[model samples]
Target: MPHRSISAPRHRAPALPSTDYDVIIIGAGSAGLSAALSLGRCLRRVLVCDGGPPRNAPSPGVQSFFTRDGIKPAELLRVGLDQLKPYDTVEVRAAQVQRVTPGFQVFEVEAEGESGRTFTVTARKLLLATGVEDELPPVPGMRDLWGRGVLHCPYCHGWEVRGQALAVYGQGKIVTGMALLVSRWAPDLVVCTDGAGHLSPNARRRLRQQKIQLNEEPISHLEGTANGQLRHIVFKNGDKLARHALFVHPHQHQRSTLAEQLGCRLTSKGAIWINKHSQTSISGLYAAGDITPGPQKALLAAAEGTEAAIAIHETLTREECPK
Candidate 1:
């Protein structure tokens, strides 16, 4: 048999007359980058627009991602960009998408680059890999400690602070559930209602049954190290609790309004609704990552992005190259 070098076949989008692309992915986080990798490999011209400041940018390291665990978030993104260097069909830009308008057979995307220059491009498909923004609690020092000693997603940061004195801070019914989740990492867990006192008697009983302490006193402020490592939480009544880490359920909103402006439906949780293939309610528009309703994680978002790209490629093939 003739020896054949097993090289990855390079695929490029057919040269179109206009400056348009097969797909334009907004927010070049894990999901957007992963989607671009798949689409580029399939010969689709992909453009990923990353505005700035990723959701996990404040975090020192990304956790729970297999093989790349503990790598800094920015480094992970840099690695992803490096991996895409071989795919000539894929390009990344640091720009903010201002608007997306549907066209005859494409979508018009207007974006502003860091150099204060504006540009527009047309794309056959749009992928909203734009992740959500974490709205931290208003408590003093809380925002500064986000993604550090103050964190969310126990599965993501739990092991890092395992066995440390952990505190869950929030109000209303959600905090009760959060307390239970945080207990897995630190048995010595405390739930602070921040003076809301929304927990029912039954909820209090449940916490006590699990040996979790419940504090209704309003939090005065959070005391942490200069580097964002939480040390103590002071109460309004002059009481202080020593805690190494605080788990919070911070409110989150979509980072970009482009999806909403495009008329895609959102979930009750304020996430972009997508089908199993990651297609949004609008045809030719897709979404993935934290913007979708699910337990948000880096690996999960990457997988969802891959799925959305495959679906987009298949749809385009069926429409453009029918048998």
Candidate 2:
């Protein structure tokens, strides 16, 4: 026993538990890709998980994006992804994030693959660029005509259908405001409140002064041409409202509940509540793009992402070298 001494067991250095990536951007739309570009330029390790096609995938083209206006949504995203190639530290993957678990210093994320498999990743900070989804009107053909005829956001699609016969679909003050805003694009605009035109006295007076027509008949279903152009809004009593396009301020919902899961505060409008630096209620958790408050434009979202990146970089710098 004295001659044959047991050797000490060999052990590899414990794997580093710190995050391999500084940020894990949960969506790869305009915001996520934009943030990744900025962070990547800073030489930070970034992993961008592209859930799928962007929320604007149904739209024909992106508008108001400088130098890239009218570009198709997929093309714009492809360009964003291509532009990131120069940054070696950036990685992009297709993932539908399912769960997030915030830990001591890192957040664990699980994404489900197309094959029903799941993978987990961790990061020091998380950025949720997961935009919102438009819940279209319950009319029969609304879904099919969304982004084309049953539209949202006058600034984005209004130019294409400008001066055409347009109708605003919704009720209450929201639709009243939408009708007024849409009037700028379509002089021949009509406000179809479906059943009740809940316009305020001021709103109704404004509509009358503006010469915007109101239709309160309960809608039967929407009718669109074979080419996807809206033709008319059919009423329950066989009455038809001929229109080329319908502007809708449909209810919107966040595409991902990650913000809710991570305990980020939500605005009354259902957007993620972020501080000036784009950091969410929970420290180290950031949000940008349509998920945040205000308007939802591709250009605006990209700008938000860039701002968030700058803020995240500054925060990380402060944490590392506190003076």
Candidate 3:
């Protein structure tokens, strides 16, 4: 019964201030921080509350992002904070939000962090930049190899494993698509359906034409070295397949429980539903990033962040002037 020590810490929110902020953004990841930068430029009082566990923290580096492609997550975030520093209106706090409640003019937020301290702040508007969690498969040893030899985004790590032996793990029709796409990087690709039904005739044809192995055996477990680098895949039949890397299609879930707790309408995939203005069904509350229940990608999350900030800014102006 011990918690994982992810980082050394001194987390404490300053005493609850009396003034109401123009905006309060929760979950300081790419989306939350991006929105804060935009609102700060407008001289809005923006408070960013960070719980500090990012979904991509396991990945070695971020890719496909313009200008900063392949940069470490910490480095990217550090540079982001430096850029946002000039905007004096923004304050970054390393605190965990406990709850959010609608108030008369805005909303009330309670946050607590290390040192057993708590602070409350009120905001005229709220933005939920909470992201999503990758629901990994229940396979043993796979979790340890995640973001190292096992990955999700081919666009992110395909180059790194190009020409290596790769395995695509999924079921049904999805595996067909993953196999075809992943074959671009590695000619030695295996489609592991985990004892699932066979692919369609056309699907099987496409895979063979691409020279990808269609493997229907159930996965007994993943084999890795003592250091946790994946070396091979062990099947239920006691056969071992050498695999340099793996591609998994994990189910995703939203990270923000507060949004659901506050009654924000969610998508079928459990993402927050927002309009063009990024306003959710709950007025004064907006959401961005993977938490919104759609396909998850970094560029898309950042775009949603910027859009939410703009929408919040407009609402602030209208509410402040009452015109």
Candidate 4:
């Protein structure tokens, strides 16, 4: 990533100043940072307000990012921030955005920091890259082993859990699909519906033909070893089935509430809808990353951020702001 030189001298804007920035980006995760890098190169005065909670905070490492696979989250951000420093156009504030509103041809941003200080930033445009969170199953011990023994995103953690005893805890058609896909990695695989009738007859037949066991009994809870490794699953019938790892498809929710509050169009699946140029229905407002409906991958999120930044630049150019 190359930094964009500031076309003009750096100057500090007043705190809580009304409508003063070219663009105010929220969240400093992969997507947010990527957007910052792009806009920073264009010499756009960009402020990134982060909630400090990234979507992949629980994951051990990032996956599927070419040439940067398995990189730690902190390390990735460090490199990204370093690259953005020379531009002097991107400022990352460790704060939580409380609310957003349209004011006098710009957007007003109200945010609070850990020090109990609240500040407001006004920008001509707003880009929301706030990512989503994984909604884990309400299973005892599941929370403790999440992102370790139990995981979501096969592409991210699948290689680590490969060749291990695996189980897919899901219902409906998803159970069979997950079981078969996981079976490719783990020879020993089981599909546990946990008493939910989600497996169709065709799916059941396929699993049986593949010699995979279909566990319909309800699961009471999961048991982990002293070292915190998942050891056995406790069924309501008092059966303790030994398993090394479990795969699940968790429910996902967007991180930013301001998008909907501002009346941006949303997809049927609850994601903010954006055009190919990353522009939302609301002019001068954009979104990227896991906030949009798609597979949640670090690379995809980063790419979406880049796209949004380019669109923002074009929009800003048309407005005749100094670049």
Candidate 5:
């Protein structure tokens, strides 16, 4: 018999009615939904362009999100969307934004849906909640364990895997710093250099003083369960390290290029630079969430989104309202 590969089903985007709105938000994650909620409450016509596959899509559940703690990321987003039901002014479409062009008084956004249908929308203000993408190391089976046993953000997943046999995977000063941070929850921690061997003398000394084991062997692959629960770290030399959890400091990049295309200044860490008002370098452009420079957390991103919505409302009122 011939073997056949099965692919996962695709999600279809909803129909988008109009081409004009008070505010057009890109990326319908927590940050985008929060902004839309605030704007909808204020009776503003808000449109949220949600490109599927959020940053947390691979994770089983969200942590440290207050009442919604431990909830599935998708369910949390569904609840958020449901909450906006009363507001007819808010609309969400599963579409990837292609480009953003500036206009005289509004910004033009071009997006393509899953069905290859293209649409354009103009808005008085634009908000970017398009989070960052995690660039994982090329070790075999690492991608399968991502967001499960192989994780990042100590604050987000540390409590869940507390006191487990944990390993920090990466090299450089940042990885050392992350190892230190992970030490708070994991007393028995090992630092895997993954053959990079870029740790400084001071970092090595600190690790030694802290009794943290440093492994410089090249990683062959990760051994995990069918459900992505990591079991062991297999080295190229045939040695294996038993690890229940692995903390990683993977490289990250902006999920969308619309921010850079709009000329929004980026921070040293490659996140969008925004002021207290959540406004970016461009006058009518605002940003929130992991795309902006700061600690990446769902709650923090939502708060920033709310703040950005308020700032946008105030700015629009100031300009449009008659004195």
Candidate 6:
């Protein structure tokens, strides 16, 4: 991604004191970093705190992103951080935000550093770019194959597993929908419901039409290659099925509770609810990335971050010069 050079303030405001930052962005993934870049160009002081490893840590490469396709997740973040070096106003840290206290026009944030040292900081606006956490099933070897043979988001990894003997894992209507979606990538797909598929007659008919095999047998475990790419689905009855990859739409939850703690409205699916400007239900509180309701992708998160940055700058401008 090309870095935007900071030329002049968008609304012509004097620099804030070093003691206070304009925005505190949590999570240093694509969303947070992209926001910092945009806000920095707008002459906004940004402090980005990375709670921990990104949600996509297990993924080997990022697909579907423009220009930076197939880049390692860590390397993409490294390049993003490196590009922010020219923006002096933007500061990135490895601190984990412990708590956030709402105040009149500012928010007090407590965080702990790598050395276990804790400090408090204040920012006028708070952006929670913190993403969500994938809750995979309890099946053995599932975690090990995650991001490799066990995958999510067909757009992100479908092409890599395309034409491979693939299976979709889940149950009920969700799995049926997933199998149909994965079929676009996998011409011949298997739907493994683990047990009692709970599929409707229509769903079964659709699967038959698409030639998707439904396996309701409970999976005992998964066997994979030496490199951890899944190879087989072992059943409780000693039966085994060969499969190169397993696609799963596992359950997910917010990685951070800052949004919930601050009483921000959440969607039915537990994502932060934001308006057109990315501002959450709480004034001065915003969210982007997978934390908010939308498709979870690096490119989409970065785009949302850029949009949030522009809106945040505008909000600040209005506050400073309210007609």
3 or 6, greater by lDDT: 6
Off by over 4 Å in 1: 1-19
The C-alpha RMSD of each candidate to the native structure, in angstroms, is: 7.1, 7.5, 13.0, 8.0, 15.1, 7.8
Model 4 residue 275 lDDT score? 91
lDDT of predicted model 3: 0.85
Give the per-residue lDDT digits (tens) of candidate 6, residues 1-323: 99988886465555433437999999899999999999999888889998878988889999888999999999999999998999999999999999998777788899998889998999989999989999999999999989998998898998898888899999888998889989988876899988898999999999999999999999999998767799899999889999989999999998888888888899999999999999999888888999888788999999999999999999888777755
lDDT at position 322, candidate 6: 53
Question: Candidate 4: lDDT of 176?
Answer: 75
Point out where model 3 deviates above 4 Å.
1-19, 226-228
> Given candidate 2, what's the lDDT at residue 299?
97
Task: For candidate 1, write residues 176-245 as lDDT tens digits.
Answer: 8998888989978999888876888888888899899989898899999999999999999999999999
Best by TM-score: 6
Q: Single out the weakest 10-residue window by summed lDDT for candidate 5.
A: 10-19
Q: What is the TM-score of each candidate against the true structure?
A: 0.93, 0.92, 0.90, 0.90, 0.92, 0.94
* lDDT on C-alpha atoms for all candidate structures: 0.90, 0.89, 0.85, 0.84, 0.90, 0.90
**Which stretches of model 4 miss by more than 4 angstroms?**
1-18, 225-228, 321-323
Candidate 5 to truth, TM = 0.92
- Whichever of 2 and 3 has more TM-score, that candidate is 2
**lDDT by residue for model 5 over 115-234, one digit each (tens)?**
999988899889999999999999999999999989988989999899898999988898889888898888799999989779889999988887788999999999999999999999
Q: Identify the runs in model 5 with alpha carbons over 4 angstroms from their true place.
A: 1-19
State the TM-score for model 6.
0.94
Return the lDDT, model 3, position 101: 83
lDDT of 2 by residue, 1-323 (tens): 46988898775443434886888999999999999999999999999998998889988899989999899999999999999999999999888999999987688988987787998988888899999888887889999888888888898988899889999988888998888888998889899988987778888899999999988999999999776789989999899989999988878899987888777899898989898989999988999999899988999999999999999988876666554
What TM value does model 2 have? 0.92
Ten residues in a row with the worst lDDT in model 4?
10-19
